[model samples]
Target chain A: MRWLRLGALLLVVGFLLGTAVWLRPFGSPTAFEMDDYFLKNAQVEAGANNVVTSVVFDYRGFDTLGEATVLLCAVVGVAFILRRVKP
Target chain B: MSVVVRTIARLLLPWVLAFGGYVIMHGHLTPGGGFQGGAVVASAVALVVIAFGAEGLKGQKNLFSFLEDLGAIAFVALAFLGIGSTFFRNVLAGGGGLFGTPVPFGPNPGWLNTGGTLPLMNWAVGLKVLAGLGSVVLLLALFGGKEDG
Candidate 1:
């Protein structure tokens, strides 16, 4: 069992290290046409200086809505589990 | 913990809260946004919990829940505002109304009055996140009937 665990850890570490070494250089994306379009037009179209904020709240608002819903559910779940009962 | 810790937490609380508000308010113009700012504010809650213990925050869970609900409702309502054109259209981007200032192209100082619904959404999300995470910490601290120094 100890040897199996050691081998598994080594395999995972080797895979992660190999993947990191083979990764692309920083600041150079594999695909950036969409990013280019956003950079060029986000300010004018969304009227926001921050492109990332524009993207999160304007261009991709549905995703934010979904994220908000998920947070709501989580809070509700926690409240339910921790509610105090009347004797 | 100690009196020193409590005093420091009290002194730093307002500054942390102000920074969080700044991050959320300037989300459309700055690197930080609603989520990041909310997390920062939530840290203040944790600090309070750690310094003063869960007993200090008794009976505040409902208030957090209410604020979270309010934030969620405000967010969805803002999204519904642009439903005339589309679900999430930038309807007020250049409308010259509330939060409707148009942004200039190229690099320049960012305006706070611009971004239309973006800033509103940032506030809504910030409120929600702060309330939710703060309440979570409070609840966890209050759980199991345990007390801390």
Candidate 2:
């Protein structure tokens, strides 16, 4: 039973790792490069000094907002959990 | 509470804060930014809390909360500025610079406060990080110990 569980866990991990390796979101483009687009538009559109910040905040502001929301949710979750326990 | 450790922490804390400030301000030109510098400053606070105990940071929880709120509000406000002109726009309304100077020249392509919302963002983040991390650690320290019933 323990061996079966271990094998199943290993199989799942292997499948997930293989999927991640095969699918690269930031991979090189076949035709046009995304970095060029980001660099060119970031300065004019975002008006940010840092390209990375522009990418994080302006170019993908919606995504960044979602990320911030995730952080907020995590903080709230921790607070809720801690509150339930006696101090 | 060892005297040597306390003395060392005292000596190092101010420098850490100053360097963190420098990193936050010069984030536009340099590699380090608001989050990195903020974490660095927070780590200094953590050091103080660890070496001196939670009592060292006592009575400052309110202040920390204020800083955290300020940072969050500033960030959100900057984002909302997009509704008018552009998101995170450098809309300083004219009088803008370090210590209210027009423009303090630094290196090329940017100034000390060249990045408009960027510096404000840095300040906000610094406060948030220092406060947020300090509070979390202090809370843990307060509740994690084996208290006599």
Candidate 3:
């Protein structure tokens, strides 16, 4: 019974994924453009050439900081949960 | 099943690791980023743990922690330089060098040595993800492996 339910869920998810892949949203732009405009500008300001690097460390640095914090919390959580702390 | 699987994973692990490193180093000039490359590296380690058992990866505990800490420190130190100028500013390499001599490298963009704090942040992320993911896999494998007695 559980296996059947799992199979059903997988089938549903696969259908949804396939539908989304083939379906286009209403009036979406056909052409793609660079989303790293801020990074491009930051290159001159930060005196860095790599746009992605500039974005990560200079332009969108707060995001990077948050990402680091997330990693720290995850590591701490893993250590706490796995620690050989006795009752 | 066990022997065949172990043989295949063992054969593939080194190649996976090398490709991960290549992706990481060339991230500045390529499409893949630190997280992608780091996960690949960690996945390679995970394969080894799966094949050889948790004991095989136990020797790497200290190395993992060290890399994580060093990456964090390098990232923060780079940011602190920007504190006086602007948050996350590339303030270093303005001028001055050892014994009043001109520095070998100074504020330039696009080169490997350039990018200010970006490369440092990338290295930090690479270390953190690689270590964190490997550790997670190790713990799961250790606790999950058991045979009915």
Q: Where does model 2 exceed 4 Å of error?
A: A16-34, A44-48, A62-87, B85-110
B38-64: candidate 1 lDDT, tens digit per residue: 999999999999999988788887788
Query: Which 10 consecutive positions of candidate 1 chain B have the poorest summed lDDT?
Result: B140-149
lDDT sort, best first? 1, 3, 2
Best by TM-score: 1
Best by DockQ: 1
Q: Give the local distance difference test score of model 1.
A: 0.90
The second chain of candidate 2 has a TM-score of 0.80
Clashes of each: 0, 0, 1
lDDT of 2 by residue, B13-98 (tens): 89999998888877755778777888888888788887898876768768877887887777788778667865654454234453
Docking class of 3: acceptable
lDDT of 3 by residue, B1-149 (tens): 39998999978988999989877766554556677788999999888887788887777888888877877787777778778867777664323231111223233433454444455566777877788777777766664445311
lDDT of 1 by residue, A1-87 (tens): 999999999999999999988899766789999999999999989999999999999999999999988988887788778767555
Model 3 misses residue A60 by how many Å?
1.1
Model 3 residue A54 CA deviation in Å: 2.7
The interface root-mean-square deviation of each model, in the order shown, is: 3.3, 5.5, 5.9
lDDT (0-100) at residue B38 of candidate 3? 89
